[model samples]
Target: MEHSMFCYQCEQAMGGKGCTKYGVCGKSPEISNLQDLIIYQLKGIACYAKPLLEKGEHIDKEIVKFVENALFTTLTNVNFDLDFHLEMLKESQQVKETLRNKAPHGNYPEAATYNLSATKEEMIRDAVIAGVMYEVDLDPDIRSLRSTVLYGLKGISAYGHQARYIGHHSDQVDQFYFIALEAINNNNLTLEELIQMAMRAGDMSVEVMSVLDEANTTRYENPSPQKVNVNIKKGPFIIVSGHDLRDLELLLQQTEGKGINIYTHGEMLPAHGYPGLRKYKHLIGNFGSAWQNQQQEFDGIPGCILMTTNCLMKPRDTYKDRLYVTNVVGWDGIKKIELKEDNTKDFTEIIDKAIELGGFEKNEKEKEILVGFGHHETLSHADTIIKAVKDGKIRHFFVIGGCDGAKPGRNYFTEFAEKVPDDCVILTLACGKYRFNKLEFGTVAGLPRLLDIGQCNDAYSAVRIATALADAFETDVNSLPLTIVLSWYEQKAVADLLALLSLGIKGMYLGPTLPAFISPNVLQYLVDTFDIKPISTADDDLRNSLQQAN
Candidate 1:
């Protein structure tokens, strides 16, 4: 028997289990199954690529890039274009064949040797059964562990994709794509071995994030604390959303002095702190809140919107005509900007649209928020932080950030951030910060009580800050008087959690809900080993965090 589609890879899985007919992210079962087919082929490609790389054979860089792009595309809310998905499915099969012929022959799993059916109709049927639920009879715990590693890789691949976009490449990080991808298809692996692989994926998460962090800083300069304007300036304008700093930089350059004001939206809000980007006088303030609010936030805005990466919503008709996507982001009807043969984008179309629209006719009331507290920027004032902690002025550090969704319990994060004590410092990143970043938390010891740590992938910066603080105090991260309260929406947050867990950092709080793929036993394993808690009421969780744990 074949199923329509089954995906529990996100926080909002239908009924907190799986999306059977349609994805909550607006992915139809056809596209959903096709994405699984692509992922299935990615594993098959990895079987060859992994062994060949281990044997010191060269693999084409495109295969690696394709894998990363594939994982990112399948990430919730990134791609819903049926045709583009079909193209990716075909490419995956091609890549698998290319890799299969290059590898030395050996015993391999069904995934490694699986062949595409002769007809498109047969292929779709096979893909229907090749989804996340393919190994239906596998142990529930193994399935959970395997999905964790797979989702973590998807998260790592998002970073790897971004890292490579900015000329950063890591052989080990690239190799792990194969190592972990191939492992997921092997049902014979024990739970312990799967855990080890999960940790390795975490280690790779940290590495790829470091690669991206270096790539971003080297290209855009290290971020410094700056008050970014949050109101609209009356002029022709364009909004850049998503996590690609490179896209924002290019858009900044293109829109400069053209009488078009560029506004950062969603995750792109932190670009205002980069000296290179901030130097552009016309790079206006942010326009909206988180990605989840886009349909309402961008309603009939008289400007162009460029979605450069993930976290995109299905565009509404009111603004879809003005919506443009580049690279791997896609929706069926929106215009797309592709890189020229030289790997550079010509945003002339988007710029022209901004001019034609003659944006907001009048200026809105001005507002500002502080941003740009990445690892280096935050660590620069380490003396202040350490001294504050030592003197007991800054009582506790709460890391409250992750992806923001339209889910109801999200108010807990808002309330949590709002209720955090005056003496505590809140370090945050991602659109999840939007829930509380607008509120005034004031300054503590010359540092803003709320420290903005850039995009979701900037979890590396958060990790670095934690590690440096631990070293400064001569203790492990868990030993520090720090509490991590996170809200996860997608695979990237999964990778971030894996990174933290791999470093042996425990006693963390995770919400708005647990991922549906984690079975009760697997969740218990995580709970017992890592002490990971599903978030309770903000007040109770905060009270418990303050009164109880070490």
Candidate 2:
């Protein structure tokens, strides 16, 4: 049984085809297969937890940990180590055993047959068997849609795990995770029911985002406008990527005055805006554009790249020795900074390595990019923004943003932004802005029209600005003359879409390519309810989106 190692966890996965022999991110077929089984078993645990939540039973912290850790394990560039997966399996089994003992007669339809410690070979055989032997299989569309929701929830769980590591917790979020996970695994579900479940997942993500927003803002203070430097400074430095602010904060603290410069990369760019983080003079500006550009951007860089979360592609040989994995992001042979049981990561080794690298000898001239237009920052300017819209100076508001990928179609985002009418205002964030941030789209009413609203997690800023505009005009958000042209390459984008839908902001144009995990029925449900359409040509899509506003 020669198995393929192709995977669909991230948009950059081997031309969007499943990896068969070894994952493009260095994940072997055995590990990939085990991950799939972990997902299957996680779904089983979620199903078991759902009835308990519904029955008003207090969901234990251990079950919540299982849900969060399982989702984190499945993220791109995370958990490539087979031993890590085995450890997770053992832990999951222990949790299940405890749960089974606690509720001997509980409703665990899926759990009845789940074996947490199954070998990779056995797991792959079971996946094949389930497809061939299951009497009642979900419709392909439903499975796709459910998978979409599951993957999106996985993104949420990753963020939630990061927040929890910093001592944040939300019972509502934990309960919803169990509910959404259960919904994905249920065979008794109808298309309509699944659609409803998907919407609910979106609605719940708002709560999740809110919790995370609170966690970030309360700990770091509201992000304010900041100019980030792209030039790497002289002396040893570590480039921190992914979206874990807590980890970034700790790295900054450990490296402070230690003769090492710290730089943000990928989603970490937004860290510069937080008062707590921005105070670190050594925390330099962003290193590269989105996650996909790492191969080129990271090449020959004289430092280590500390990845706190997903969006990691396969490491190139040039810088492979310098990459460090933390939190859930893992790669074989890479030095992983293990977190204590309480989620605190010790960065003493990472710091020592940074010093050993002896980064660039000369200070690089400052290369700056503007960012930090998050909700709190934007809403602070609500009066001015509302007045500008009323004055007809800001004719159109176009939210052209999301995660970035290496796919050829993604260039459409850059072209679309470049082609936006001179009178229109473009608000962007995340790695997707790499597409058009270089273009000089002048300001409107003294404010730069091309606004970078932080990272994908800062989609909350877009939501807040839209709602504030609506409230100011005393109208619904959809009725406002604003357009959302989104480009997605990962699960964070999926979670952001759910947030938009939960708020009833419809007529979104989403693209790059439709998620391979989304089923036809689920797509139809989204198309019907949210008017979500795939991206077309830049000119055509922009014209159509603006026309709808008209």
Output the number of the TM-score-best candidate. 1
Off by over 4 Å in 2: 5-9, 12-26, 104-107, 118-137, 341-343
Q: What is the lDDT of residue 514 in candidate 2?
A: 81
Candidate 1 lDDT over residue span 181-226, tens digit each = 9888886788999989999999999898889999989988999988
> Candidate 2: lDDT over CA atoms?
0.79
Candidate 1: what lDDT?
0.89
Give candidate 1's error at residue 154 in angstroms: 0.8
User: Where is model 1 more than 4 Å wrong at Cα?
Assistant: 1-3, 118-120
Worst 10 residues of 1 by lDDT: 115-124
Clashes of each: 0, 11
What lDDT would each prediction earn against the true structure?
Answer: 0.89, 0.79
